[model samples]
Target: MTGEPVLLTCDSGGVRTLVLNRPHRRNALDAELWEALRSALVDAGADRSVRALVLTGAGDAFCSGADLPKRPSTAHPLHRMRTLTEVTLLLHELPMPTVAKVTGVAVGAGWNLALGCDLVIAVPEARFSQIFARRGLSPDCGGTWILPRLVGLQQAKRLALLAETIDAGEALSRGLVTWVVAAADVDAFTDDVTARLAAGPPVALAQTKALLNENTDRTLREALAGEARAQAVNFATADAPEAYAAFAEKREARFTGRWAVPTRTEDDA
Candidate 1:
């Protein structure tokens, strides 16, 4: 996982695929890989050419965990924790929709990374685990915060406390993953979703994401007001006109907005 090349490439329909390239290490996140991934995510979010992102791994495993060899580093432990927190926050704050395509084992921080995405589509063969407990450590990479929100508090406790591996079927059933396709179909399914999102209204999607992330923490009055404000802004976009016109013309709407919007600052649960 050390000094591994980050696999980043954008295709037609504005789908940017960030593949974890360290197959030998099961795509573990070493310090270098973390920085590379942070930079790549930042660049993709800023690039208008990239409307959607599909985060996946290179070979058999989606990701194992943080690179164990890099632990207890030259820097202070608290510094490492702070750095990891910022990196995880960056992933969660990306403007465009991110979909994690999990095909194999996604353990510890790897699982958390996938959970950070707006949606996760995994293959039947994929497995997920929060193995930090097994290794005599606490969870990192937004796992502690995101897991409880995804699955209930009890489920989150089970995952973190037991540190046991669960398969894709269980993950989907527990509301952790959005969908579970066959192993051969995971890539194609993710591609289809990404393409669909890319062709849709980018501003609307971003607004929806923003609302979702803030909804649980906001009061009902505040949430409604926020939605109305967001809707007001979205209605003024070019895509909104095209959408109404397409409806009247009995055709599909072709949306094209690509700029990133400012993420709303809100307190987390």
Candidate 2:
């Protein structure tokens, strides 16, 4: 534990997988892993080649939430929470798609972490809980906001107020997880799903994600205006033309996400 990195990173097929590496503690996030996650997310956001991202853990468990034994910071509680807030915002707002691959325990902030991703693929053995009330704390890491949105207020209350651990099947039924795959097939399924997402038109996907995230607050008029702007931006990328051509030719579109808008040259100036 002394020399091993708190987070492990891997890149393959345009996907970046960030593994939470504290398995001995059920991959509970500590100060070091939190900072590492922030750095990794920033790097991924800046690298357009990384079209998809995956968040998982090293051993059996995905995460058991923040490590209670280790006090991560001596600063004020507000300052400490800001670190978590940053990580939450980064994961939620990443331009590319994100997936959470949960195998075992995903509780407290860990469950919220999975919820923050665009999709969650959990194995049959996966267990989830809010676990905040038990810890005498309310939800953090965007749980308070995301839970109600995903499962509705009543169910969200049942989870947060009671902090009951729910199994994978129940989680799926309650909309806590996107899919509950067999433990044997989780790796292959995750790879296939991420690859398919990566192969899609990046510009359109990003815009779509943004649109959905903002939809909750915007009015009908505002939402339509946003979509119009998004479509205009999409047309300025190489993906839109490729999509049209592929549709006409009845072939799969290979989107490159290359910018196609004309640049102002010295002569134009």
Candidate 3:
């Protein structure tokens, strides 16, 4: 579409949504769209008000991967790939939880994009593929790293090397998908889930997410120490005390993520 944003963004209930906007080409990642995505992700990561993030595609198909025919030839592949690497790392490192809502095909880099999220939800008819080998390329967008961690080494190899497309059920079986729901209910289900996440204790949830992501590479002792550090930080936040009070009162906790210890404010000065 002429003069349209390559990425569409919206905010609701502390949830930020970033949608790939190139539906006519199955939301392919041209250079423009990649930059758009990176910018949006950076903004989402920096915004403390955003407690959860959702990524999806417009019209149909989550994404078909790079727009090969339109890919820029001016720069070397390595240089061009830095953008993808940054985007992937940003998604992985964002403080809040992230979700991928896959409506249709998510292949190649597109598939890796979804895999980078904390959770993935897809419709029954959705499809996924590593799709790199068939295109005479290796996986990018953190695909190589995330695949084996998600599936086993063998399953990851099969998907990446064979480049075969899989239905949502098989993806679910292989643990690539968190849930597969009816297309009709996916929107409402996603909304409900993200709303719940947005309402969680922001500081604690962010620390928990970071711990889990880093634990795979950590020793038992290191992970325990990390957990201790996270808990110490959480204890300094108002939410932890609020939760304790709510439990004693037999009511729900309203977490504000404010600092529990006294701190100087501009008004105090």
lDDT of all predictions: 0.86, 0.93, 0.94
Give the per-residue lDDT digits (tens) of candidate 2, residues 53-168: 99999899999999884535568898888889999999999999999999999999998999999999999999999999998999999998998898899999999999999999
Write one digit per residue (lDDT tens) for candidate 1, span 1-269.
44446554556678888888888889898777788788888787788777888888989988999888844569788876776787788888888899999988999999999999999999888999999999999999988888888888999999999998999989999999999998877778787898888888988888899899989779999999999999987876778888889999999998886333545577632
Q: In model 3, what lDDT does residue 193 have?
A: 93
> Predicted candidate 2: what Cα RMSD to the true structure?
1.3
Q: Which segments of model 3 are wrong by more than 4 Å?
A: 264-269
Taking the tens digit of each residue's C-alpha lDDT, what string does model 3 give over 32-112?
999999999899998999999999999889999988965449888788989999999999999999999999999999999
- The clash count of every prediction, one per candidate, is 0, 0, 0
- As for lDDT, the candidate ahead, 1 or 2, is 2
Candidate 1 ranges beyond 4 A from true positions:
1-4, 258-269
Q: Which sections of candidate 2 miss by over 4 Å?
A: 70-73, 266-269
- How well does each candidate superpose onto the true structure, as a TM-score? 0.91, 0.97, 0.96
Task: State the TM-score for model 1.
Answer: 0.91
* 1 versus 2: better TM-score goes to: 2
